[model samples]
Target: MLDQTRRGMAAFGLALMSGLAPVSAMAEDRPVIAAAADLKFALTEIAAAFAAETGTKVDLAFGSTGNFATQIREGAPYQMYMAADESYVAWLAAAGLTRDEGTLYAQGRIVMMVPHGSRLAADGSLETLRAALAAGNISHFAIANPEHAPYGRRAMEALRHQGIWEALGPFLVLGENVSQAAQFATSGDAEGGIIAYSLALSEQVSRLGSYQLIPADWHAPLNQRMVLLKSAGPVAEAFYVYIGTPAAREIMKKYGFGLPGE
Candidate 1:
């Protein structure tokens, strides 16, 4: 559906370009922003910084990128969206749901993680996992639901690259989103799981398990993209800008996200 709501979007961008605050912040005190679950920790820190620096609150909802895209298509009231996979944003832009195709804010990586007491090792090469599986020592392996989660899709690709996807099905534990997948990966419920490197790097997750970075060539790059929806306002627009700032980029790097330029 053509987004008739996008008619005045140019004005918002122009105002931003002119170094002026958008004309209105809208009646909503907080703009709802949808983000991919891989950003759970990093984006939270950035949002906290955003509020402290600008004194404006932005509500964030994190989940699978594909699920959010479906909601956005059905007119969900998200003012901005940050997707784990850029293709989702591109699809929305083509449907006229976005102010534009948006920004490639970050690139994500995956890691295989095992809880503290697991028999499996967090091996990037996945040789340990292959050996453990062959020895019948594997119980459950976790990942996000590939049907709707970008991290899960990448995990599938990586597993396939190693010639294990078909055999691992019976032991697979799928989470609805990558963050939950991370939770499952480290919660002692499974042997180990492939999950977002950003989540694996966080203090909360690192304390629970050990992780090793999967080779980037194993799957497609997680080219994250962010976009403003038709209903975006002053605060939402400002928050969008804040994401690309040096301060925000620094915070993202702290959590292992690859910045756009460096």
Candidate 2:
């Protein structure tokens, strides 16, 4: 009986030690992620899920990819970068900021959104917008700054493709990033904004306004990519693998994003 008691006590002690172990001693760990602003909602949820499953935490910093790229070049301590466009990731790879081959994580679609109480029709096509502009109903339109945001560049491309760049040029209100552009639309600072469908599907925006998807063909595809930095730890690699799993892909789809392989 005494031997049995001793064995039980030893087992309990081992279990306690395991439970009390520091997170740094774990086989895989969490990584600091620098992500594009448009991915705020989706990536947060995904990060939480990844943490629950793998005991990995994702410390995320959300901003424009261009700015993040500049920071990374300046030696920001991020282990991974998720950009809203492939070009940004490619540029980082060229600059030796990350691994040469980055994974294409998701694709984004653009939309036009209006404020909660606005009576504006949900017509997002160029012709519809032209008519609204002619009527002087859309006083301010928000877009991300094209200098640093791929979505903004796409918005500009769409306007130019429709031959309305000069006509709509006067009403353009620029946000620092796509998420800010959505905020501009939601806060009524701008009557409408061209933003990512991902942001449009977010709970805050969905409750604050409605969106009409811009035609996919109007601009180049927004293929977002994620690259693991050379400085990435095992946790970062594990998280990267987690994102490509079926579970994460489902989460992305729920948030109005499409996976690359899909």
| Most accurate candidate by TM-score | 1
Predicted structure 2, TM vs. truth: 0.86
Off by over 4 Å in 1: 1-27
* lDDT of every model, 2 decimals: 0.86, 0.77
Question: For model 2, how does the per-residue alpha-carbon lDDT over 61-109 read when each residue is reduced to its tens digit?
Answer: 8889899988988899899999998888888898887876699989999
Under the 3 Å rule for N, CA and C atoms, how many clashes does model 2 have?
0
Clashing pairs in 2: none
Residue pairs with backbone overlap in model 1:
none
Clashes of each: 0, 0
**What TM-score, computed on C-alpha atoms, does each candidate reach?**
0.90, 0.86
Q: Write the per-residue lDDT of candidate 1 for residues 1-262, one digit (tens) a residue.
A: 1111111111111000113243333545799899999898888888888877766778989999999999999999999999999999999999999999899999999999998999999999999999998999987888888889999999999999999887787788887888877777787867989999998888878888899999999999999999999999888888899898888899899989998878
